[model samples]
Target: MPSEQDLRTKIESGLPDLHNLIVTDISNGCGQSFDVVVISNTFEGKNKLQRSRQINNLLKQEIAQIHAFSCKCYTEAEWSKVVV
Candidate 1:
């Protein structure tokens, strides 16, 4: 039953070096689904699937609270391209 603020706070605290983190609740007020986009240097050398696995592992507990998750994980270089 955590609020979006609580979720964001937890993610931020857990990922200190993450550059961009976005979490959206998509469960029609049920808090059971979320869409997340995270950009981090930690993902620099990883493939897409590996990056996703890393995020899944970090948010294992939170993931249990969500029934569905749409995630986009990106490295710093990829993020820079999008920002430009």
Candidate 2:
């Protein structure tokens, strides 16, 4: 089983410019579920689904290791909206 640190490393490698990346392991010892929230400028012009697809594509291998992933991806603008 890959450690959380390993997973985070892989994610960071895949999306180098992503900011505010939050990854939580929701499954104990299963390595099969996660909750992720990521903020990035790469998501700026994309819709929610498109943004998700971009993440999913980058983490395709990780997806096989994961059974469930609840993801929330936001652009800087969207994140600012939430902060305000």
User: CA lDDT of each candidate?
Assistant: 0.80, 0.78
lDDT of 1 at 31: 83
How does model 2 fare in lDDT? 0.78
Clashes of each: 0, 0
RMSD in Å for all candidates: 1.8, 1.9
lDDT by residue for model 1 over 1-84, one digit each (tens)? 655666778778876578888888888778888888898888877899998887787778878877787789888889878889
What is the C-alpha lDDT profile of model 2 across 1-84, one tens digit per residue? 555666677767777567778888889857778888888888877888998897888777777776787789987778889879
Measured with C-alpha atoms, the lDDT of residue 22 in candidate 2 is 82
- Candidate with best lDDT: 1
